[model samples]
Target chain A: LAKTTQPISMDSYEGQEVNITCSHNNIATNDYITWYQQFPSQGPRFIIQGYKTKVTNEVASLFIPADRKSSTLSLPRVSLSDTAVYYCLVGGLSSGSARQLTFGSGTQLTVLP
Target chain B: SAVISQKPSRDICQRGTSLTIQCQVDSQVTMMFWYRQQPGQSLTLIATANQGSEATYESGFVIDKFPISRPNLTFSTLTVSNMSPEDSSIYLCSVYGTGLNTEAFFGQGTRLTVV
Candidate 1:
């Protein structure tokens, strides 16, 4: 498993774009980057995932640099409901099976009204 | 996506007692996992519940402490035995969706508070 580092907390106001970066210096070639959001008293929800370059969905955008050592999750027009903890995980197929995801201390996003 | 239902969403238990958390998936899945999240901490993998055979636990977690059972493809249970105040946390059950780059679906989680 690749270890990830992220900020402990971030603050933003409504309508502002929030970007959270995660560093995984020892990322493996087969590893894929995934981001999950967790609200209070709830399970983590899938935000976005990407192997390289950029991937976008209606909810968020994932940008992986060419080196693939780091990735950023970009949330557009944030709202108060966007406040949650975000986790970045790096894992891939191991022996023909998906490796169990190991979560790190996530970045807590606090969206102010 | 799979739907998971966990019984007894929240509970307050006394020390030395045991609590069994049940997880049921709407459809059959090949893999089921149990995780624990301590207060103000990240989630930790407890074990991977394998059907028919014994579950494979992660480091620092033992079968005696956190026994897991997967009798079939859609149902599993995790028993927290001989609980203490330190055992208070949220337990979540998860399963992998179909495909190579599939996402995992998780249950609402069981919030256990030991007194």
Candidate 2:
């Protein structure tokens, strides 16, 4: 598992597009980039994941560069309901039964009305 | 995705008492995880629970303080011992889906407040 770095906080108005970047300079070949969102007093919810290139899901889109050293989570048309902390996790796909997650400080996305 | 049901959504406990939190999944899962999140803090994994095997504890967490049990594929328990104000936090259980790289799901979380 490699360490990840993300912005401490971000602010965006409702209906805006927000992009949060995560840097994992030491990422390994087996490592995959995953994103999770968490609200106060609740467990984190998986948003999206990508190994390379781009992967989009219902909630968010994940973009990985060719080097795979860093990735970005793009949240389109943000809303007040999307205000929460976003986490970027770097871990191997074959880590076995337990995909034990290591969380960084995370990027706090505040969606203003 | 797996659905996890955690018992005792929230509890207020005494300093010397213990509270056991139960995590039951709707379907069989190979691995179960326990995590703790303090107020306005990010989640920290406590241990990994596997059926028929002893839980694997993480750094800064010990068996006596946070004992875990996974009796079968679908159920696990985490006990917080000798509670204190510092132990007040949310405990969550998570499990990976059937395939590798599959999304992981979590319980709503158990809010524990020790006075």
lDDT of each model, Cα atoms only? 0.92, 0.91
Second chain TM-score, each model: 0.98, 0.97
CA RMSD of each candidate after superposition: 1.2, 1.2
Candidate 1 residues lying further than 4 Å off, grouped into runs, are: A94-96
* Candidate of highest DockQ: 2
Local accuracy of candidate 1 as per-residue lDDT tens digits, B38-98: 9999999999988899999999999999999899999999999999999999999998777
* lDDT accuracy of residue B107 in candidate 2: 94
- TM-scores of chain A, one for each prediction: 0.96, 0.96
- Please state the error at residue A63 of candidate 1 in Å: 0.5
